[model samples]
Structure formats: C-alpha cells, structure tokens
Target chain A: MRRSRKKQVIPGFGISMGVTLTLLSLIVLIPMASLVINASSMGFSTFWETVTDKRVLAGYYVSLLCALTAAVVNAVFGVILAWVLVRYDFPFKRFLDGLIELPFALPTAVAGIALTNLYSDKGMLGHFLGQLGIKVAYTRIGIIIAMVFIGIPFVVRTIQPVLEDMDSQYEEAADVLGAGRARIFFRIIFPEIRPALLTGFGLALARALGEYGSVVFIAGNMPFKTEIAPLLIMGKLEQFDYHGANAIALVMLAFAFLILFAINSLQIYYNKFTKQ
Target chain B: MKRKNLITLGIVTTLLAGLLTGCAGKAAEDADGKAAKAIEITNVSYDPTRELYEAYNVEFAKYWKEKTDQEVTVTQSHGGSGKQARSVIEGNEADVVTLALGYDITAIEEAGLIEAGWQSEFGNNSAPYTSTIVFLVRKGNPKQLTDWDDLVAGGVGIITPNPKTSGGARWNYLAAWAYADKAFGHDQDQILEFMKKLYQNVLVLDSGARGATTTFVENGQGDVLLAWENEAYLSMKEYPGEYEIVTPGISILAEPPVAIVDSVVDDRGTREVATAYLEYLYSDVGQRIAGENYYRPSNKTIAEEFKDVFNLELELATIDDELFGGWDKAQAAHFDDGGTFDRIYDGETQE
Candidate 1:
C-alpha cells in the first residue's frame, strides 16, 4: 500500500514552485547576484581597505550595538504589552494596544524628525534633560531610542497572537492549586510565550540591523562615534565610490546572516527546552 | 462564534486606540484661482534655501503685486534636489525649476522636461546664482580638516550625502575629483585613487544635504561635513556658536540655475507673471536675499554690495562637460550607486 502523500495548501507542485522560483529570482537572487558581480571587479585589497576603513568599522559597531540594545529592550516591554492586552479589561485598552504598531505604519523620516524634535537638547522634553546635563538627541542613547521606537512593534506583534491563544483555564487552575502569581507566571506563562519571544527577538534584531531612515536623524551619524553601517554605505555611494559601498554592504550582509543564524539556533534551543 | 466576533471587534478597537497619532502639514496648492490675479511660480529647490527663497518670493509677490495688483503665490517645494528633480520628472506640476545644481535639471531633461538647449534660454549654460561646496568643520577645526587631502587623512571623518542620489552630493564628489586632478595632475588613475581614500574616510553618508548637516552639527559624527556654501552659512547663522564654515583651498563652484517652464506658463497664459518671477530671482532685492543665504548673487551690483560678507574665493576647482564629462558619464563610470564606486567598496578594485 502507498503511504499517504503530504497534501498541501495549494495546487500541484510544479506551478507553485514555478511562481516561488520566479519571485525569488526577481526579488532576491538577481539583484544580489548583480551586486556581487559588480563588487567582484574590485581588487581584494581595495575591498579589504574599504571594509576596514576606520569610519566604516565604527558604523558597523554602532549598527550592531544599537540593534542589539533595541531588540533587548523591545523583548521585555513587548511581552508585557502583549500580556496586558490579552489578559486585562480596562477603558481604552484597545486603543493602547493599537498604538504599539504606530512605529510600523509611520514613515521612518517622519518618525526620525519627531523623535529628534522631542529629544534634542533644545527639544520639548530635551530642555529638562539638558538642564540635568543629559544629552539624548545626538548620541548613542538617541540611536537606541530610535531603534527601540521601530523595534518594539516587531516584538509586540510577534507575541500578541500567542498570548491571545493561551488557555487562561490553565492559569486559573494553577492559581486554585495555591501557586503564587509570580510562580504561575514564570512556570506557566513564560514557557508558553518563549517561542514567541524568541521569534520577536530575531525579528527585532533583523529590523534594527537594516534600519536607516529613523535612526539617521537621531544617530547624528558621527564617525568613530555615532556612524552606523548603512550610513557608511551611503557615504561610500556619495563619493561615487561604488566598490566601497558594496564592500560595506557585503560586510553588513554577512553580519546580518551570522546574527540571524545565531537567533535561529537560539530559537531551536528554546523549542527543545520547552519540549523537554 | 459570537464571542469570537466580539473579541475581533475588541482587537480592532484596541488597535485603533493604540495608534501613535501624527499629522503632516502639506501645501495642497490651489493652482488655478490663485493665479487669476497674480502669477503663480513654483521652484524645485533643496531645504536650506527655503527661507531665503521665501524671502525672495515675498518680495517678488510684492514686486508683481504692485504691477499687476494680483494675488501671486510664489510657492516653493523643498527637499533634496535629487528628489525634487525626480518629482518634476515624474510629473509634479513645477512651472519654473530652480534646483541646487544643473545635473538634477539635466536628469529632468532626460525625463523630457526641456529639450537639449534649455539652459541657454535662462542663462548662457550656467545658473543666475552660483554657490560653492565647502567643508563645515567642527568649531576650531577639531580634526584639523582643511582641504580635500585632509579628508583622506587617517583621523578625518567626512560627512556628505550620497552623490548618486543627491544633487548637492554630486557637487561635493566633483569638488573632490577636481581637487585630486589639480593636486596629482589629471591622471585618471590618480584622481580615482584619491577619491577612494576620501570615500574610506567618510563615516556617514546622509541621503540629503540637510540630513548630512544634521549628521554633522546635531549628531557631531563626521569631523568634516561637505555642505553647500549657502547651506553651511545659513545653518551656522541659525545655530549660534555650534559650527564654523571652512571653505576648502579649492572647491567646485555649484551653479544653481533657474529656467521658466515655457510650455507650462504659455499654456496657462501665465507667461508675463512667470517670466517676471524668474527675472525677479536675478534682480537686486532677490539677489540680496540669495546673498543673505550665502549663495553668491549673479547680479554684479548685488555681489559688490555684499562684498564684505562674501570672500573672494581664489584657486577654485571647476568641472565642465569636456573635463569631468556630464553627470551621466560620471555617474556611469564612478558615481552610479551600482557602478565603479560600489565595486571599489565591494573589493573589486583593491590590490
């Protein structure tokens, strides 16, 4: 007897694969390949020099650092936002939940300008902070704020569905069995949301890594100081130095892959741990 | 299922409630009725010039208002010049296009804004007003950046916008190329090599002139910020005690030209007023406002009057179609985002 086939969502395999391949080539492969081919014309030393340039290196550091910080901050708060929205009843609760996705919908430039205005030394809240000798608008701190502004939505969106689906019956049972709120949260709620948190973290990191518009204004784009990788690539392009831009882009692309890989492995480990 | 519907409704309501609300103020210009009495003119310019241009606009309105007794709205759309040009090319109704550089206008021409001989119609192959590219260094020259060579020096962090996509950035790139050719003597390889070093030193390449300035002055990232002379001057004027303008030893003269859209005005019977508006930009009052913004006035009398504020910049680096080739050639060979310059960064040119 023949084993049952893995029936799927769509029609026969060839048509689906044809569309998938066409999409992949058009959107990803062709453009990426052209970039690589163009970059290959540059001699290896030039490529090395471009990537190792002090300012480019600084940009790489800033891009990595800000993205990580934003991802971490988002993971924590995102979980709470999702948890509250799912498990609570309050006036205008829906409104507050909807606001979490604002960063996703708003133009990055508008967001950048708004954040810069609100946090600059002479900005609205910045005046108070400035009096306390706190510089927010034009620093690494400002970069993190911009990144978090964009990143929080990624995490919150990822976790909200999971929280919504969770059985509150299990939570109530745990409570009736005399378990404390904190313990019940840690043992029951945390494990269930772990998969989502991991997914959110990965998404947040990826989003932050590629972000340019929102952070550019707030980052102040200083070299060996606040310069970010995307900005470095931009600098390369402006000077009419295509290879330099590509070299920087290649490095960023590699770093992104490595980070995503690590994120995937972590996801795997979390899944295994949850299963156990 | 009813409970599920209720939950869906609740989710939708909450999503709406939770949005971070904001609004953008846009000038949806009423182009027709406003032009009935006074002439309506629009220019595609970069952001920093908005204030100066607006001053000219007010004066222009008054000049024409006195003549025609009409309500002329001299509206201006300001962004990076590249974007402005692209918008014009993509069919934004700009009657008179005054961009940060000629190349952007040329790009629009390629998109069929005007035929080949359009520049000569306004001013003989150049702009009515000319600005230069300069280095906006930190106060007191913290990184010791003085010239094009200094930008390539190890410690220098040069800030500029993307040349391939920004009109002002093309001037900055051309200035560097001009400097390199002058210093190293016009060997194609030497100029290319010098530019490669400079690119390596750039820490932040913002998308536009204002963005680059914000990167420099606000973020304090790059040691040297390549800026429009007028923009640098205006920005310093706006922010007292934040930065200093350091004109490079030799820099490219940026000619921001203006040409009335002959067809647009002729079709609408706005020729007299539109022509008057374009002419007004080169008049004494208009030139004074332009000078106030640090753009060198084309009108001779205006220049002489503002002599004290304006420096006689000598030993200037210049580019033309024959020497540097046009923007398309330069972009294809070196500046195009996907061309030679990108390849250099991609490690195709090293060693």
Candidate 2:
C-alpha cells in the first residue's frame, strides 16, 4: 500500500475528489443524462420530425430573436449602469447599486405580472402609446421587455466587479499623452473590459433563452406568433407526449450550447486580437 | 467568550427539542391500538378549485374524525389542470386528483395511476358539480358582446386560454364550435372558417384559465373573456361593477371530474379514506359547499336553490356527446399536435 500510494501536496485529496464527483453526478449529471436518454428513446427520425415541426420551428425562431434583442439591449444599458455606479458618486449610489439585483430576487411571475400591468393598453405608459397605434403587450416587444427585465442583472453582475477593479492609472497615463476621452476609451479602457463584456453578454443571452415564467405571462402564447420554446415543451408535457417534449428540450439545449460556445470562441479570439 | 458559550448552548437546546419532536411523532404513528390514528392524504387539483377544496377539506376532516374517530389530515396542491395531471403521472403521490376535465383524469388513467372507467366509480360520472362556458365582458356590456357571433365579429379582441394547455379553453373552443355548427347547418368547412375567425380575434391566449382572467380583468388586455361559468361568477362577485357575465345563446356543459389515484392510495394504504373522501363530494354537505362556491351542484335540490346564480336556458353541447364524440377522440382531432388547433394557428400539415 505504501509503495502504490502517490504523494500529493494536499491531504484528503481522494476523499474530496470522491465527494465532489458524487455530488455533481447526483445533482447535475444524472438528471441531464436522463434528458438525453429520454430524447434518444424517441429515435432519431422521431426526434428530427418533432424538432422540425412548424410550431417547434416557430418557437425556436421567436425565442432566439427575442433573446438576442433583449441581450443586446441589456449589454448596452448594463455597461452604462456599471460605469455610472463605479465612476460616479450620486446621492443614492448605494441604493442604486442594490437596486441592480432586484430583478434577481423578485419572483419572475411577479415581474411578469407587473410588467404586463404597466405596458397593457389601459396602463399609464401603454395608454399613451396606444394613441400612436404602437401596441406593446401581447406582442414580441412585450416578450423582449420581460426578457430584458430578467436578463439585466446577469449582465450587470458579471461586469460590475471587473469595472470596479479596473485600474485608473492607465487612464491617467493616456490623459498625460493628450489622448481624448473617446480615444482613451476605445484604445485602452475598452480593450481591458472586452472579455468581461463578452462574458456578460453571453450570460444575458443564455438567461433570456431559458426564461419561461416572465416571458410566458407576457408572450400571449400565440402558436406561430409569440410562443417560446419552453412554452412548447410545456405544452407537449401537458399533452403527455413526454418523448416529444424531451426531443424539443434537447434541441433547445443544443441551440443554447451552440450560441454559448460561439460566444466563448469569439471571446477567445477577442483576447488574442487585443493582446497582439 | 460568554456569547460564544450562549450560542453553543442555544444550538444544543434546539437540537434536543428537534430530536424529542421527531421521537414523539414516530411514537404517535406507532401507538395505533388505543389512541386515534393520524392519517394524511394529498389531493392534487386544478387552479380554480383552491377555494372549493379548502372549504371541503375542513368539512371532510371533521366528518372523517366523527365517523372513524381517527384524525385525518388533508393537503392540497393546485395548478393548471393539465399540469396537475402531468405531476400525478410523474409520481406526485396524489391520493386523489380533482382536475378541471375528465380528459385530465383519463390522462392519469393512461399513465396507469388510476384504473379505467373511473368516471363510473363515483356519482354523476365522478363530477360532483358541473359548470358551463360563458363570456365575461367589461361592465355595462361594452362592445355589446352578448353571444358567440359577437366574439368573431371584426375589431373584437377576445381573451381565452390555449386549449392545448388549458381545459377551460377546450370548453371555450367546443362551445364556439357547437354554436357555429348549429348556425351553419352543420357545415364542417363553415365551422372551421368561423373558428379561424374567432381565434384570429383572440388578443391574448394565456396558458391557463386563471391567467387569462388576470390578463383580461387586471391587465385590461381584451374586450371579452371566454371563461367558465363559476369563474365568471366569482369575477362578477369580486369586481362587482367592473365586469359582468354574459350567458351566450349556446355553450358547452363542462364536467370537471375527480378520481382517486388507485396506485397511490394502495401504496399509501389510504384507499379507504381516499374513497370515502371523494364519495363525500356527492353528499348533502358537499353539495351545499359546491353550490356556495358557485359551482352547479349535482344534487338536484341544492342545484335548484342556485338557479338565480346559474339561470340560463340556452342550448348546451358536451364533450362526450355526438358533436365532439369523447375526450380521447376530441383530444386527438383538435388539441393534439398537428390537430385542428395547430392547423389553424401554426398551419401544420395535419397527420
């Protein structure tokens, strides 16, 4: 036993490794494995047919389009919000910082309801927009709004710490070299935070893609129009077509993974380009 | 150091108390010969039955205690009817499922959770009370949404849940189908055309009946809401002048069914109590409670007393009747994937 034992810097390594693997397998891997097993049980042809159905295709389209739009919106506003919080000292600075995480804590159902109530035709903002014939609730715009609500915190939380840790010495050096505000931001500040921004955008996109509760309440759930992928999965589950539900969910997972992978690759390329 | 000692002392005392309670509970469960045995049953139901079952559970517990002298505990889980049924099929351990439609209970049967012919197991086809579909419009009948025709008329924003996910929306769809079939001399194409128009006018299709009501009432999203008679009545009662129920000239009689999950009851050894609990729904007290909740009770005497609340003399079709056939056929032809609903909305090539 002494001859076979390998020397390690940390003791209890075997036990710790065993515990981590067991916990992960039980909590995450096993459930995901079941989803794969269920989807495979439907057979490849059946899976292809179910995922390629017109309604499922519509769900995928609507979910991707809305999530993309919402993520873009969140990225723009999240950067601004973090910049202000880090660089400026307003009266309600601390309160505003705390408020950024409200969406994370408030139940998505309540957010959906409150958002619907605010943007409906009879609501204060909606009533004014109705005069201009611009309907928001029960439309794709409403779905995007709900998604933006749920996704804002992801972007903000991911970028805020990086922004807070950003060195001010570089900006002072650029200023000494007589670089303008716009030039310094583009050549110096932006390159430093590019990786964090990409990570934030990826997280916000993933969150919006899987968002169900808030989107469902405001999506209007019109089958070829405003329906989302998760709602289609729910509809299938309700119909007792477990195989079909699993097939669609697997497709969604694949799509989300592809997008996240693409974002990660882009982030790597960004880092490579900036370093050179 | 003193504060640290106090914290340790408090934790020890709490742990000891928890241990004592656990032992006491185990002893109570094991002490079955002399003392009243405590039993718990879980009743999984649909969204709108929250109020109905809360009142019924209390009454049933009291009745069970008086009858068997054993303490009875009843717990309820409520959500969308189809979702609730899906949970039971996924092993929710529901001793009884009081869903919004017989179709949902049949789903449980299909899952082998309950036996076949569960409808015949209890009185009145296992539906203690029945309700019909109706239109709930803004107060003063704005837009003059009186009957089915008005729902499909141009510029009308109708509010109803998706039939694919909601039992109430199935009733609303069938009610519309029945009206169109009768009005157009039973022409199938005309009925489809009419239904297409009606759905085209649907401003928002919620996932569940209660959600549709909230969208229509609270969010003010639509002009008229197609809803269950009981839900419409409850809305009228709650928001007195904000909305009013419009009993259409034709509608579908909705039978929301209940059944004991045979497998679950057998596993829990609560079959006797579960059976008796459901049978109690057909009893006199249960009928009174059902009527009080705005449901059209199956008890003839009690139903007659609630005529003023449910007074309607319109033609009503049913899901099990000739037009729609039965739940299985209806589920296949209409709400199933690539069925009529998908054809109309998503333009699926029907299989």
C-alpha RMSD values across all candidates = 10.0, 6.1
The top-ranked prediction according to lDDT is 2
For model 2, the superposed segments whose C-alpha errors exceed 4 Å read A1-12, B1-36, B347-351
- True contacts recovered per prediction: 0.11, 0.55
Worst 10 residues of 1 chain B by lDDT: B20-29
DockQ of candidate 2 relative to the true structure? 0.30
Best by DockQ: 2
Candidates 1 onward: DockQ, in order: 0.11, 0.30
The 0-to-1 C-alpha lDDT of every candidate, in the order given, reads: 0.76, 0.87
Best by TM-score: 2
Error of 2 at A157 (Å): 1.2
Model 2 residue B257 CA deviation (Å) reads 0.8
